[model samples]
Target: MTTKLPAAVRDRALQIAHHEMGHYVMARALGFVTGGVTLTVTMDLRHQGGACITLVRPISSIEAMKEHLEARMMVLLAGAMAQTFPSKPSAAKRVDKPKATAILKGEQGAEQDYAKIRELQHLLRNIAYPDTDPVSCERIAAQLKAMTDRVWDRTQKIVEDQAEAIAELAGALVDGMVIVEQWGRAADTYEVMYTGPMLERLRAVQAIPSLCVWTDSCGDAVQHWK
Candidate 1:
């Protein structure tokens, strides 16, 4: 039997789903092979916020690796972005005004994501502009945000397109009724408890062609490999 989830738990799960799904969808759209996504609940205070995991393919070269790093950073940022601007009002409606204000005041994973982006900037600078001074870091930060902005629309569409799937998965996680079926080293399948029309809706969304398109800025920087 599936356990009933409290209002807070349900909301938290949906937040995690949107965040993680952002990574998963973008990674796939960028032609990076993904190992699937997983959502889990935790009692650990540090992780009580919830966990969403998306496994991606390994990078092959330094130049190619940099592109992958940038993509990953954007994916990471997508989670917090989704939280800040949820696709559906219901996802965050239950949050109290004060708590909602707090969420808006601070992003979900800003610190970690920013750190990763900074690290990626350092690596890219070393390769392309090693002689630059500290001020260059500021420029790199701007460039990173610009890159993220370029694809923001696509990310939003993914979140919106799969909103129901995310909610379903979130509900499953909250109920502690998720079933995992590993599929070799390629992908991992998650079976949620809920069924019926919602599943059909998710399949319909998945059937739609990808709306992701590379902006000129990112297109020039990250070569199309697939």
Candidate 2:
């Protein structure tokens, strides 16, 4: 198929790619095992979407659990933060937090992501405070919101810092050379494994210097899952 396409189509594809990469990049940085990232956009607009599947290892300690939850939230928030990228490269560093936060608060495409974050938040809250008393529950809710906001801020900063990396990966996707979506797969099915050279290229585009440290910390958790 010819790579040439309308400008609108290309823009949408890049946007979707960036959104999924936001999650994929953050997840990898946090040592979460990613199944892969997929982007599908056909003439049928109803089926246009992308995903980055991540797997967090089971934790033996409460501390690990908390860290994992916070990491997951950051990963989730990264998607929206990426989508809000300014069209001008020079403005990437100056991304307005208020506008980006608005997108995260209730972006149309991010409902599912926000929902997932909420569920994770709920889990974290329950783990942190098991008490069912009304007063304790209210206080815990406030504390949890604070924690969530902190994670959101951290995620936004990471996205801002990695703006170039995210754009590079998205461009690779738009070029249809490195990572191309499987048009033959069913629209609803979104499972792709980024292995071999493809995975290497993806890593090359996004330099996560801390990946080693993160992996070392959670490497044991992976073995436990198997």
Candidate 3:
């Protein structure tokens, strides 16, 4: 017998899928090795909020680490960014009063993402400018935001292109056929694993391309799709 999820449950599943897919797509674009992406839903009140986790390899060097953290921050922001900046709208359209207000208000999990971004920013600033004063942190934050904004358009394109893959992953989650016990957790929360050939299939079906082209400076200066 097929089971039907409640409307709320279904909506939440889609939300989690998009959020998780954002991380997965960005990580791959940045050439990070991902173990997989997992989406777990539980009935326990303590864990009522669903989670979408992307497993990635550890960074190897200080410079590489900074780039990795920045990439991760952008991926973290991508979920809430999608909620506020729909693909149909351009940056100009995003300036409308209602949309701008909604973006400012943010969406679920946005606080957690922002907190992570702030932590990464603090670390980056400390390493890059150890002698910087307190006010410089705010300045650094703005620069980080500006950099993130520069890539928002490309991020939206990736999200749009990978929509079918995301939905497929979400459907698999709802069907309960892809459960794996989460690592380091005593509780029996299950998550779907998308790794190796499975992940390649997802990317292939979507024909997703790199989100940016690196320049000689090693910065993502161009957004190219295949």
Candidate 4:
């Protein structure tokens, strides 16, 4: 299939291979398993969530919690970060676009997902999106940039200090990708297993249903079932 990437994305496949490798391995070193990096998808090939590393083991501890939250967010930002490469119009344009699957969906899907993204932006501004802070909008934007920056920094360390773990986790995630989406394991792969401490704090200490569990599509179809 044809794509709209710039002509200057030298070594297109190589950069994505390493970028994803960084995320996949970094998550494992932080204690969560993830899919191995892929070379098949590159600057030219990556679309929305094109270079995702299926997270494994989830975030369930303190250090692991911090690392996981920062790591995944960084991985989400990798697409934009990578665009800061051989060109400007491409880099600037790519950086401005949303870096998630919902962003790539059609107009209605983007609209549907806008609520969540707006909520994310709002919480990012307030830090209450996940109980981080209630900073002003400027501060929130700064914090988001800072957090993603940290993720990028730590991702480098993860690649350097934990290459083997990343390779292993990536392999495991890729092996399980079929079941990753099929067996109600999005949480296990993305949401559930990677729960941050704030989530745990809310659930265990605060005793709230902040993150409800909908085990099935059919359940979602019937509001009262869950």
Best by TM-score: 2
Q: Model 2: how far is 106 from its true place, Å?
A: 5.0
Which prediction has more favorable TM-score, 2 or 3?
2
Candidate 2 residue runs with Cα over 4 Å from true position: 43-47, 56-58, 93-106, 135-138, 177-197, 202-206, 211-226
Which stretches of candidate 1 lie above 4 Å from their native place?
42-63, 85-110, 134-205, 208-226
User: Per-residue lDDT for 119-211 in model 4, tens only?
Assistant: 443443343246554545676677766654544454333333333333333233222221123355332122012223322232222221111
User: Lowest lDDT 10-mer window, candidate 4?
Assistant: 205-214
Residue pairs with clashing backbones, model 3: none
Q: Write the per-residue lDDT of candidate 3 for residues 88-173, one digit (tens) a residue.
A: 21222121324422432453444666677668766765676666667776777776666555445545556555555445554554
Q: lDDT of each structure?
A: 0.47, 0.63, 0.51, 0.35
State the number of backbone clashes in model 4: 10
Each model's TM-score, in the order given? 0.54, 0.74, 0.59, 0.35
Q: Please give, for residues 73-132, the per-residue lDDT of candidate 2 as tens digits.
A: 888888777877754446544346666566566654667787888899888888877765
Residue 202 displacement (Å), model 2: 4.1
Enumerate residue pairs that collide in model 1.
none
* lDDT of the structure predicted as candidate 3: 0.51
- lDDT, candidate 3, residue 49? 24
lDDT of 1 by residue, 1-226 (tens): 4444444544555666555554554554555544434554432312323232344657577666666665665565455544533435465422132432344335444455556655765565566555666667687677656654544444455555554544544444445534344556532222233332333345532553333233432444544321
